[model samples]
Target: MDTVLTTRHLTKDFGRLRAVDDLSFEVKRGQVFGLLGPNGSGKTTTLGMLMGVVNPTVGEFSWFGEIPNHHVRKKIGAVLEHPIFYPYLTGQKNLELNAMIKQCPEENIPGVLELVELADRRNDKYKTYSLGMKQRLAIASALLNEPTVLILDEPTNGLDPMGIAEIRELIKKIAANGKTIILASHLLDEVQKVCSHFAILKKGRLVHVGPVDDVGKGAETVEVKADLPDFTEVLMQFPGTASILPENGVFLVTLREDFHSKDLNAFLIERGVVANHLVTKRKSLEKVFLEILSEPR
Candidate 1:
C-alpha cells in the first residue's frame, strides 16, 4: 500500500515515432505525483498506457504492487479527455447517471457533489453551469466510485484564472483527504504548487525526476549590486564568496556551502560596502524545466 503504482521501462510507439521511451517511475501512497512536460512530450500517452487504454510497445507496470486487473482498475478514477455530460441534465442528475454506469451507489452522489463544492448548485442544469462548474462536475463523476487513486490530465487546461484557482484548491483538498493523485500538466507553476514529487518528460523520455523542493537546490546564488566601483573586488575578500560573475550590470555571486545572504550582507557592511540592491535569486521551476529540455538528447 505504500507504493501505489510502478512502471518499469514502459514504452510505446506509433509508426515511426516513439511516444514513450523506456519511461520508469514510482507513485507513492498519498503523494501528489506530477507528470510534467510540454505538449507531445508523452504526458497523456503515458497516462493512457497506465490506464490500460493504450497498450505499451514493450515493458510493464503495476497497480498497488500487483499486475493491473479489472479489480485494480476499480481502485482508480481518471479524466483523460475533456468530459462530456448531458447539458440539459442537472448536476445531481448527471452524477446519478454516472453512478449508475459506474455501479456506485446513488447515496455517494450528495457527498461527491459536496466534496467538489457543487452541492449548492447540484439542482442546476449542466447547461446553466459555468466552465468551472462543468469541470468540477466532471471530477465529481470520476470520484463516484471513491477510487483510491485519481488521475487528472490537464484538469485546468482551458479554464479562466478563477476557474484554474478553483480547481487547484479542489485538488489540494482532495490530496488532504488521503487520496493519491496523479496529475499530468504543462503548467509548471501549478505543478510546483500542488505536486509533492514530479517527473519531467521530453520527447517521450524522462529527463528529470525528484521532489519539488529539490528543483533548484544546489549551489545558491545571490544578486548583489553596490554603488562602489570596487564592489566585486570587495565581495571576493569575503570567505563565503564562492564565485562572482557579472550579469546584467550586477554581480551574480555564488555563496559557499555555509554562506547565506544575511551573512554576505553583514560582511559587506563591515567592509564599508553597502549594496544598493541585494537579493537571493531563488530559481523557479520554469527555469529548471527549460534547462532540462535544452540539454542534448
Candidate 2:
C-alpha cells in the first residue's frame, strides 16, 4: 500500500518536558489510523507537529513521501483540539473563509456542509449550533480543500452518545470514499470501531504500533465455568493465572498467555468436573489501551 504519512524519529521538547519523543509511524493510503492514549499522552502534540502548527524539536516527517511543508500541507486537512471559528459568523460564512484561505472554489462550501450533515444549519450562526453541530462544521471546513488526508484530534469530545455515533459514521463514510484519516482520540472503543490501524502513545513516547487487530492479538482471556462447587480450587490448579472474575454464576479466568480450550476442558474432566460453559474471550481495544497505559515509561 502507498504511504500517505510517515514519521521518522519525530521528537518535540519544551523546556524540561518532552512532548513527543522519537515517534515514528506510517499511515497508509485509504486507511483509518488512530493515535490513541490517555490525556497528556502527547497525542495532540504529535498532531500539531504533523500539521506544522508546532515545529518539531528533532527528527523528521513527511506527507505523501515528501517533507512536510506549506506545499505538502495543502494536501492535508486537520482539526486540532476544539474547532475554531468566529462564533458570530454563520456556518456557511465560516466555511467560506476556510475556502478562501485554502484557495478552493467557493462552491465547495455547500458541498462540504452537506457532507457533514450541516447543510440545513448552514445559515445558523456558529454560536447557535450545538457542540455536535460545531464538530461537524469543523469536519466540513477540513473537507473544503478535498485533501487526501484528514487529521482530527479528539473529534468526538464533549458530544453526547448520539453525536459521537453520528461523527463515527461520518468518518466511516469518509474513509469509504478512499481518503486516508488520522484520528487522535482517547476513546478506545471509538478507535476500535472506526480505525483499521493504530499507535499507542505514553508520556511522549510511542509504545505500540500496528494493525488494530494485531495490537491486542494475544491479550484475550479464556472463560471457564464448571458445575463443580469449588471454583476457587480449579483456579488454584491453573498456573500463570492473571485474574479471575465471577459473573453470571461463572468464573472468567484471564490467563497470562494463550492456552488450548481442549486441554482446559480435559483437565476439568479428569478432576471429575463437568463444564457447562468454556470459551475464549475476545480482547477489546479498551483492554489493549489500558495495558499499554499501564506499562512503565
Candidate 3:
C-alpha cells in the first residue's frame, strides 16, 4: 500500500495543443502499473515528464514523497527506446561495458545475466542472436544497477510472436522480484498479460483507472427469453442462478463456473417451459478495453 509515485493536476502543453491534461494518479509499491492509450494519447509525453526529460507547463509530480533528482533517478532504471549496443560485441561484453559507464559493480553482471536467462548465451555476438535474445539482453542491461523501479516504454515493439512471449515471461519474472513497474504501451494484450492495475487515457485525459478485475463483466453471461409472461417467476425459483435481470425483452442470467447454458435449457425443459432465444458472452480484458474506448467522451 506504499505510494511510489503521485501526480497532481499534471499538465503538459506544446504551444496550444495539450499533450497531458490535468493527469492525476498514484502508482503503489509492487504494482505493475500500465498507462494505456492509442498512438497519440500522450502516454510517451507523460513518461517523459516523469523522467525529467520534458518539462511540464503546469502542475507537478513526485517520486515517493519528494521531487526526483540524480539519486532518485539512479534508483529507477528506464528504457524509453530500443537500446542500440555494439552489434559485434558479445552480450556479456555489452552489459559489462554499460555497467562500467553506470559505475555499477561488475559483480552484479552474472546474477543479472542469469536472472534474464541469458547466461548461456553471454558470449554470443549481439547481431548473431535472435530478436528475443536481443530484447532479453536489453533487460539484463537495465537491471545492472539493481534498481528498485523499472520504466519500460513499448518493451516489445519490434518482435515476432515468439519474441513477444519471451519478453512477457521475462517481465513477469521481474515483477515477481517485487520491482514497481511503470509500463507505457498501446498493446492491450500486453497490458492484460502483466499489469495488475491500469489507467486508460483518451486524448490526453484519464478515462479509467482500476484493478484488472474491475473490468470483469462476468465469466460468461447468458441471455434467455421465453414466450410465457411469468417465465421470470420460474427462473427465479430455479437453482444455480447467481443473478437474473430483465433487459429489453430478455433476462440476463449469470451462472456459476460449474454451470453451463445447456444446464439452463435442460432445467427449463424439465419445468415444461422453453426459451425462444439464448445467447452467450465470454468475458475478456480486450472486450472491456474496447467497450471503454467506444463509450462517448
Candidate 4:
C-alpha cells in the first residue's frame, strides 16, 4: 500500500518541556488511522507538525511521500482544535468564500454541503445553526479542496451524545470513499469503531502501534461455569492460562497473549471436565487502551 503520511523522529519542545518525542509512524493509503492519547499526550502536537501549524523542535514529516510545504499540505485537509467560519454569513456563503480561498471549484460546494447533510440549510446563517450543524459545516469547508487525506483533532469533542454519533457516522462515510483519515482522539471506543490502525501515545512517547484487530487477537476473556465442584485444578494445568478469578459460581479467565477461547475450551474437553456455561467477552479497544495507559511511562 502507498503511504499517505509519515513522521520521522518528530519532536516538539516548549522551552524545557517536550511535547512530542521521537514520534515516528506511517499512515497507509485508504486507512483510517487513529492518533490516541490522554489530554496532554502529544496527539495535537504531532498533528500540528504534520499540518505545518507548529514547527517541530526536531525531526521531519511528509505527506504523500513528499516533503512538508503548503503545496503538499493543500492536498491534506486538517482541523486541529475547531474550524473557523464567519457566524454572520450563511452556511453556503461561508463555504463559498472558503472555496475561493482554497481555490476549490465552485461546483464542488453543493456536493460537499449535501455530503455533510447541510444542503437544506445552506442558505441559513451560520449563527442560527446548532453546535452539531456548525461542526458539520466546518467539516464541509474542509472538504472544499477534496483532499485525499483528512486529519481531525478531537472531532467529537464537547458535543452531546447525538452529535458525537453524527460526526462518527460522517467520518465513517468519509472513510468509505477511500479517503485516508488520521483522527486524534481521547476516545478509545470511537477509535475502535472508526479506525483500521492505531498508535498510542503517552507523556510524549509512543507506547503502541498496530492494526485495531490485533488488539483483541488471542487475548479474549473467557467466563466459564462447570458442573464439577472444582474445575480450577484442570484450568491450572493449562500452560496457556494467565490468570483466573472466581466470580460467583463462574470463573473469569484471562489467557496469555498467545492463547484464545477455542484453545481453552478444547483443553477442558481433553481433561474430561464439562462446562455448563461458557462465555467469552471479546477484547474491546477500551480494554487494550486501558492496558496501554496503565503501563509504566
Best candidate according to TM-score: 1
lDDT preference between candidates 2 and 3, better one: 2
lDDT of model number 3: 0.86
> What root-mean-square deviation over C-alphas does model 1 reach?
2.2
Q: Model 3: clashing residue pairs?
A: none
Q: Against the true structure, what is each candidate's TM-score?
A: 0.90, 0.87, 0.77, 0.89
**Best of the two (2, 4) by lDDT:** 4
The lDDT per prediction is 0.90, 0.87, 0.86, 0.88
The number of clashing residue pairs in each candidate reads 0, 0, 0, 0
> Which stretch of 10 consecutive residues in model 3 shows the poorest summed lDDT?
212-221
Error of 2 at 182 (Å): 0.6
lDDT of 1 by residue, 68-163 (tens): 876677678888867679999999899888887768799998898887889999998999998777888899988889988999999997899988
Candidate 4 Cα outliers beyond 4 Å, as residue runs = 231-234, 237-240, 256-259, 266-276
Could you arrange the candidates by TM-score from highest to lowest?
1, 4, 2, 3
lDDT of 2 by residue, 1-297 (tens): 999888999999998999899998989899899998889989999999988989899999988888678878777889999999999999999888888888889988878887888889899999999888999899999989999999999999999999898899989989999999999998889999999999999988999988987855674567887766787687768664678888888787777665555666777788777888888777888987887778776
lDDT tens per residue, model 3, 1-297: 889999998899999899999999999999999889888889989988898998999989999888877667767887776666899999989988988777889999999898778899999899998766776778888888988889888889888988788878878988999999999898888998899999988889999999876666445678899999898898887776888889998999988777788888899999999788988765666787788889997
lDDT of 1: 0.90
Segments of candidate 2 deviating more than 4 angstroms: 230-248, 254-279
